[model samples]
Target: MIPSILPTYNRAPLSFVKGEGVWLQTEDGRRYLDLGAGIAVNALGHANPDLVDALTTQANALWHVSNLYQIPAQQKLADALVERTFADTCFFTNSGTEAMELVVKMARKYWHDQGQPERTRILTFEGAFHGRSSAAIAAVGTEKMTKGFGPLLSGFTQLPWGDHEALREAAAQADVGAILIEPVQGEGGIRPVPDQCLKGLRDLCDDIGALLIFDEVQCGMGRTGKLFAHEWAGVTPDIMMVAKGIGGGFPLGAVLATEAAAACMVAGTHGSTYGGNPLACAVGAKVMEIVASEDFLDGVRARSGRLRQGLEGLVASHPEVFEGVRGTGLMLGLKCKGAPADLVQAGYAEGVLTVPAADNVVRLLPPLNIAEAEIDEALSRLDRVAARVGSDAG
Candidate 1:
């Protein structure tokens, strides 16, 4: 029976009442350690004081104002984004899919303004997950995402994941205006494209005069300990999309681009009513302040090392459940031999929350600011889950 809320998710039986730091409380008062961190959205963790303050302060002052009017908070957030990243311009959105849509438009229009309207093709790879929107579905036409959506949007070409030769040939082709890819694929079993490969792709795009777009929507905002995942490769894209942690749990996303790449996006070309709403921008700005600090990022790196070591230990201890662990910083994945969903259920029973992903991988996206003690507690819960899984298999 379909409930009014839409049965899209195979949701766990648990219903959380409230959250604080890296913990979620059930209505009946059981506390669960939140390793998922709302799929990497809660960078500062649930009900963060700074973000709460930012939201409430803005709510007291103002709420919704159309982009037609000058919004200082929005501008402030844009300035912060531009100052920290490679983008010369910023466009706000309510979610990652919307930001992705804006980027697609910007890329096609940039070539159009240059009188090369035929160059509208975008290159993506296999095992990529963009978003759920139409354009996004077409951008990443995985069978699971495109089953019902027929006659998918055109102009997107899917390349084999990690095939450098194929990528080179495709990049050399005409009508290829832009190349869109994720440096660290969040939904593709936590696969990270090698650093040398990113450098090669960047060089190839530069040679072919194609705009490079990095969908850092899942890997940005300190999820990888760096400001963006591409920072590890030291390659910057002409355009980038960021969401998730940028809002610290509030819905906020942004499309960032170089001035030359965005030159064609003039007035009346595109706009969003609630894209840069003061409320979203206010919280986003505070999140930026906290995540952009070197001290905080350094701490994230430390925690990542700790988690990696602990997971490696788990793999050794419970070879029946896990094979290995992968991913950078807080965006980790435990490669499971058993069903990932079953492991997630085990975690639920042990008072820990984890997310299941493709390739039998269970993801751990703990908040960037999670405490050391919480990390130990989460590991303890995972150890218990491992024992349960092993016992059941036996």
Candidate 2:
């Protein structure tokens, strides 16, 4: 292999030539069940006909248009998001990190606009993965990700995951402006904050008059059998960031907020060039149409049951490899007792693709539309990999 242009991202040896539905084909014509789904971006599956058509149709019409112009597709997608969720306004971005950056600005700017500029501190959780940008990294500035980044950004505080006492203390402080969290911690090994805990946080935020922000970059959309993960807790966030599944593999993200919370972002507040391009919005609109349907969401719940049950059965048979299973719906995780990366590699070799996340867990983010037979096939491959890895460890 030739040297790459960028040193970032440890490249996997296998290169996929084509993908359809929940399967990927390598250059050598070998097929593999793709449980990872491009880290949960391919919500409708790879090369989905509807998404492809939407993209191609829009590409022939218009590809790039500045935010200065009236983009109908952008408005349509935003309308869909608002109609389905608690947000009354929307801001588009090119990726989750950018959406998060906008969120940080919006949260702080809200307090600043209200004449309390000193209340700028944003509370984040330990082991949370926001993104790689300066502000996003600062929000999640633990030792692992912030070692090389000099002089972490100010006005961000960290607390242990699910620490109610710490959260209450921080919220009580006058400097704290908002609380940011992932309803289900995606990169932190699919650790889901309890539904009751989410409700408790909502109540706390309400009492403190602090905004509650949910980073739904990974666990939102249909992945959690709900339009948004917070819906399960019967709580709504003041501001939410969504990406990954919104574009159905296209680069798109959005910040959704209530009318009062979003009022601070007035004219000349923020902007993005390719944030709401017609091409991406066309595809995103289609994705929203499909994933937001009652039937589609119900199917996600049903499929989630089958997948979780299969994984639990796998764990029962191969306890040495997988200690437990966690997370909700299609965004499931296998807590690996052995080497998670090794297990991922073994699964790849056995014609299955899995993603390795933090906490020594392997994530399964198969397409929301994956069939029952494909689920069975993925389970069989996992069984083989688990047996092999377990035997070696034994």
Candidate lDDT values, in order: 0.93, 0.93
**Which residue runs does candidate 1 get wrong by more than 4 Å?**
none
Model 2, span 1-394: residue lDDT tens: 6565766778788999999999999999999999999999999999999999999999999999799999999999999999999999999999999999999999999999999998899999987989999898899988878888979889899998878898888888999889999999989999999999999989988898899999999999899999898999999999999999999999999999999999999989999989999999999999999999999999999999999999999999997788899999999999998768989988877999999999999999999999999899899999999988987887
For residues 253-308, write the lDDT of model 1, one tens digit per residue: 99999999998999999999999999999999999999999999999999999998
Clashing pairs in 1: none
Cα deviation of 98, candidate 1, in Å: 0.4
The superposed Cα distance between candidate 2 and the true structure at residue 213, in angstroms, equals 0.3
Q: After superposition, how far is residue 191 of candidate 2 from its true place, in Å?
A: 0.8
Ten contiguous residues minimizing lDDT sum, candidate 2: 1-10
Task: Determine the backbone clash count of candidate 2.
Answer: 0
